[model samples]
Target: MENEKTGEVLRVASDEERDQAIIDAGFIPGWIGEGGLRPEPLHDFEPDTWNWETGRALLEAAATSINPRVAERRNIRMANSAAEKRTSLNTIHCSYQMVAPGEFARAHRHTINAGRFILESKGAFTTLEGKKVFMEPNDIILTPNWLWHGLGNENLEAPAFWIDFLDDPLVAALKTIFFEVRDEDYKEMPIKEGSHHHIRWRDLDLQLEDLVPDPNGRYGKRLQLQTPSIPTMRLYIERFDKHMTVNPVKSTANHLFICAEGSGTTKVEDKTFNWQRGDVIAVPSWKLFNHRASINATLLEITDQPVIEALGWYRETTV
Candidate 1:
């Protein structure tokens, strides 16, 4: 007989000997042994580190990964996250949203605030409320908490890619986080052009001749084109002539300004920062500021004031 331990010829063991060997190995015997021995618990655990480069690679992989049949059935083409799993508390969920030409992601909204940055495709715009802002590669769109919005691909041959960021912790903490599919699937309104009913990039470049300045000493023309009741607020691009100035806005939330064309300087508090096209600047909460654009300049400004007002936290002062 071959020995099981050494693979050498040996005599076969009897049942009694086998039982003896098991006892010698310090293991409980089956059926009639003393109470089973307990093993040590593995209590100490460590989590993996989060890396930016790894996150980028993982996102890219997910963007190109094939969708499983089950996912396809549910319209889940690609679902991935910065965390290892969707349930992980320490990770950020990043899903790759790819809409084929002429497809839509359906209108939806959640308690979590989200922002989407375009990675590819043209002729697609996100309609927030009634405003349809055309998207370009690297264009960042903000989807504030509880705002109804949708994305539509107008191009016939290009796929659109976007990176979505959400307030994951807040959603998970409140347990009120959810996404809803609207009955209409998409907003029923047509895309408005040239600031007729919506604010467009081109319309922002025109002069502010129609804006009548306030008699109350407010600097920039205080025309109430879009009000907080409208759900979203937007401002067009135009240069502030050499001496023309804007009064500081003292508000609870911050303001986001994107330089779409030309160069300029923004005075925030006592600091002045120069800005140019593609530059995004955030005016911190409760700060006093004004901007001066060089030559022929244009800017796109989006702020959280309207959203804050809806929540009853908006405050402002004029200087």
Candidate 2:
């Protein structure tokens, strides 16, 4: 028998091998043998179930059936997420998240375009663009590139859950996905309470009235709500509830939309697609499209138009 820990070796009968000798000495074999297999890498188990198109569809469908009121008061938990191949394109990332009553997710921001759709929660909320909008289970929120945002529980008794999406490829491509923490735990400064920078669900309708038809024929109806001058745009619930407007966007960059409430249809080129709460639609660069709501709806739309314009690559046309 041999005691490796104490550097002592004892000779046993030639007929007894290492295994038998250890048993005779009342000691267990703790070391792994040479023939044992090693563990596999995590990339080997990457997700095979989701693609960009399918993932977006599944998220939209799930959001439509969620109960906002209950989610607000109760808590929900998110399951593990699987990755998709299209992730290589546009450096996009997607995941699901759920939270229960009394649980809170930390506030954060990055240089990517981050979008979220409430999966469940009645009184949950997302503070973006300086406004705290109650996150009805199906509502959608947008955290544009380099913006500060946070989530909260409005109803003390309810839970909340939502999905997160980011243009990871763009950030990775640019090699600039920097994140910073605020000293106050939240970035509640730099914006005024009643300023245009802050927008709520109620502000949707008021903002829509400000949309004027396109003076040039480049778009059926074009309203540059936000630009480099503003840096952000807000479409409140009221504006989404009004008559569906068809505005053509001549794209130089990708167009992103987050459904806040209700359902709608979008005409992309020659095709029309139905959209509901929590749906995140991404129109690729240089595409022509128009949006219509079935009923009153609220939506937060964003785009890389600023990036294109800055690079002198933006152009739009309307017929």
lDDT of 1: 0.51
Q: Against the correct fold, how does model 2 do in TM-score? A: 0.52
Candidate 2, residue 167: CA error in Å?
4.5
Pick the TM-score winner: 2
> Which tens-of-lDDT digit does each residue in 1-319 have in candidate 2?
4434434765544534666777777975555344345442112112111222354445445543553333431222221133433441243444555444544445556776666656677766666654565565544566777776666665667556566655666677889888753322323533224433333334444555677544553222233443233332222232343455666765545555556567777776676667666555555555577777788665555565565677786677663
Clashing residue pairs, backbone N/CA/C < 3 A, model 1:
204-237, 237-299
Number of residue pairs clashing in candidate 2, backbone atoms closer than 3 angstroms, sequence gap of 3 or more or interchain: 26
Model 2's alpha-carbon lDDT is 0.51
Give Cα distance to truth, residue 283, candidate 2, Å: 1.1
